[model samples]
Target: MKKLKIGLLINPVAGLGGSVALKGSDGENIQQQAIQLGATPQAEEKALRALQHVVDYKNKVEFYTVSGQMGEHICQKLQFSHSIVHTTSGKTSASDTEHAINEFENIDLDIIVFAGGDGTARNVTKALNKDIPVLGIPAGCKIHSGVYSVTPSAAGKLLQKLLTGEMLSVSYADVMDIDESSFRQGIVKTKRYGELPVPMDLTYIQAVKQGGIEHDELVLADICADILENMEDDTLYLIGSGATTKSLMDELQLDSTLLGIDAVYQENLIGKDLTALQIEELVADYPKTKLIVSPIGGQGHLFGRGNQQLSAKTLAAIGKNNTIVVSTKSKLKALQGRPLIIDVLDQNVAKSYKGLIKITTGYHDSVLYSITD
Candidate 1:
């Protein structure tokens, strides 16, 4: 196999700004406090997890990294030979990230792989856009960009396919960046720019985004508020897509996987991106869990659109009685009543979801979207 000259960059403090994080930025004294409070710097973990995607290809490829955390330490641990992006300092920060991204702009490497969140992707967009094909290992909290994989291991699995030529055509996606300082104060703001190179056709990965909601997002907000009024403490609401799911997540003052399946009861996510075994484990103990999913605006199908999160195991685990699909009249009308697909990892599990399901639209209201062979 031809060795690919892959570039690697790790944003050591990417996940520092999450809600539980005392310091949203690793540069802040808040990071130390968060560590004391038992929170790991998830950026490094995300970077390492992304690195794990290439573990099997260790002998077939080499990597180039920046100094310190962005470079040798991570590369050494992964045991992949690599080059270093010459940095002015021994350590790296957001500035170093920009520098490293800029450095790779003209390099002839096969692909540049970085472990970070939207911020890192945003910086790369500002620096270059020549199909310099890049992949992201999500290490930050608000991963609203389309460039990230569903999980660290999924990123690795995708890379494995790419390396073995098992993947499909690559595409460019928009990048987004959010102001961390303001978000912590309950004000979320995001802006988007044009497309950048990213692997496409991976049902399990993302490349599109929903930045800070503007007037365009309000319609969905109204829908979620309606869902919230009926969501009691016992109901395990599974909010899917459309304006409705986003609305519920925003009003609940809680987070949703947005595009992924979240096993939510009252207000907590019992499991996220839950696998078959994990769903079985959760239902084994708490069988009251229900599913919340919505079909895409135009596409009639529900299961296959970037929602690999609600695996057959999860749907069967939640059962049809507890399964709830949320969509507006306009969205459902657009579907033209096509049967939704239930593609997942396990065909046997998908069979258990056979039956009629209810979709809640508003108070004392619902419509039926059925499952068929």
Candidate 2:
């Protein structure tokens, strides 16, 4: 059997701003500030998770990657047979990512697996231009792009399948991203930069994010009524990001972060756009708390897609029973019978909430939904 050639790339700074509430780490200033805010590099850890799945197949594959944090470090750590095709500075940039891809163009690679978010996807698409198939490990904060796998381990599984010829055929997936400036200000402005050739298996790869539907105003009103009626005094409520949840905040006449987490107490917006640390601090002051979250449209993700602010520690503290999920019937229908996905970065945490859970659809209206990782 001929060994399959695979190219690896990692954006070391990718997703560094997620926990600290910076929205993204696109620029040097933002990356530095995120580190100063106590945010750590997550892309390397996420990349290692994906690569671990393919470790047993090392003898059947040859890996090519850039030097240092871009790729070589993890390859060596995992003892994978890899060669450093390009050298990168200790500090990496988008130009380094593009240059690495340009170098890979001379090699005959079966696939190029990258660990990063939408920005990394855009850079890869620009360099390769669909010249080869690519896959993404979800390591960024705002993953509105379709290029990423549903989870890090799933990326490894998909790569294994592709290399063994178990999966075939490729489809164009949208590479989308949001403006960080507007995103940090509670505004969501996404643009489709380009598309990349991804595997056709829908079970492994995520679909492009869908825009908010014009749900019936009355339904939203009913949901708000139910939430307000159930509000408990002296207890904190962590509001997750989404259009549906924002409507609930709007009904209460309280300020809300459209694409960021917020804290509420007695129906008052106490904290707008909070980080994980900020949430922990508030949770300490108000020991009793409930989390209000909504699913991502088309993707069916209840957590870890765009709401990293609700870290595993926060969720564990909030408890699953204390969590309330709200979504319009139309949104659930669009899921096409798929279970709500969870990628909280900790498998044990994601597995804690299995089986059916209730989703608050309207006033005194709820539906049982299955939760999965």
Candidate 3:
């Protein structure tokens, strides 16, 4: 059996800004701010989970990695056969990431698996000296890029398939990043830095986040009106980020955290840009809270894209039946027949989401949509 040689890279500070509601962890200042706000780095832990899924295939796989948290530590912990091709100490930056990829150029590897967000994806594309397949572990805030697997475990599943000699198709996925400055101000402006070859299996890999919004004012208003009419007294509404959900916030005459989770009670804005812990606390108090979320455009992900604040614990407390999904008809149509994706890290919670889900398209228009893990 031929061994599948893999390259691993982990960005230590990749997701430092996520749970703190900083939008992204792109700059040093933002990283410190997120830390000060009590945001914990999850890049290494997330990468560990991805690697755990492939530990059984260690005999069939070999790894080339950078020293320290970048890759070496995780490889050592997993007891995988690996060679440290690059070394780094102290704080790492995009330069370190690029330099590591430059080292990978010297080794003929089957795939380069990285743990970071879109910013890391950009660095990988910028430093690639060859057409090697890449996969992302989604350890960052803004994961709008298509190069990422839906979840860390999903990335492992893909590696497991590759090790078992499964013929997975490869395709060029766009490497996308957003301006952190604008993103902090609730404006989502994504720019395509470049593309990278990624193994394709919609069941595992995700699609690039679709930009732009529905311009049909009537449709948006109708959808918002329906959601407003259904708002019950004493009910705490946890509004998920998106244009559609923001429309509801606008209709309620509330300040919307356009890119962050917000809390509404009796149509009043109470909490803005809430973190996962904050959401859980709020749910514990209210007990009658409903989660309103919209599927990301084009990607059709109702969870695990940009809304990390809705952690598994928060979801379990809110209950699946208490959640409401809203989307424009055009957005759903653009998906063709693809079901909405559920990429939440917790398989138990994600599993409960299988089967058909109803989406509110307008004031009286609704459609049943299927969701997949």
TM-score per model over all chains: 0.59, 0.96, 0.94
Worst 10 residues of 2 by lDDT: 207-216
lDDT of 1 by residue, 95-206 (tens): 7777887777667877777777777777777766466887777666556677776556567777787777775677876676656666544455667755677776555465
Mind sharing the TM-score for model 3? 0.94
Q: What is the C-alpha lDDT of each candidate?
A: 0.62, 0.87, 0.88
Clashes of each: 8, 0, 0
Candidate 1 stretches greater than 4 Å from native: 19-38, 87-91, 129-131, 211-373
| Candidate 3 residue lDDT tens string, 150-214 | 77888999888888889989999999999999997988788999999999998788777778777
For candidate 3, the per-residue lDDT at 141 reads 81
TM-score of 1: 0.59
Task: Name the top lDDT candidate.
Answer: 3
Per-residue accuracy of model 2 over 1-373 as CA lDDT, tens digit each = 8888988999999888988888898999999999899887889989999999889888888999999999999999999999988897677999999998998888998889999989999899888843788899999988889989988888988888866679578988899998989888766789999888887678888878886455689998898899989999978999978888889889888988788898888888899989889998888788699999999998898988788888888888887899999998888998888889888667777877767889999999999999887
Provide the lDDT at 173 for model 3.
91
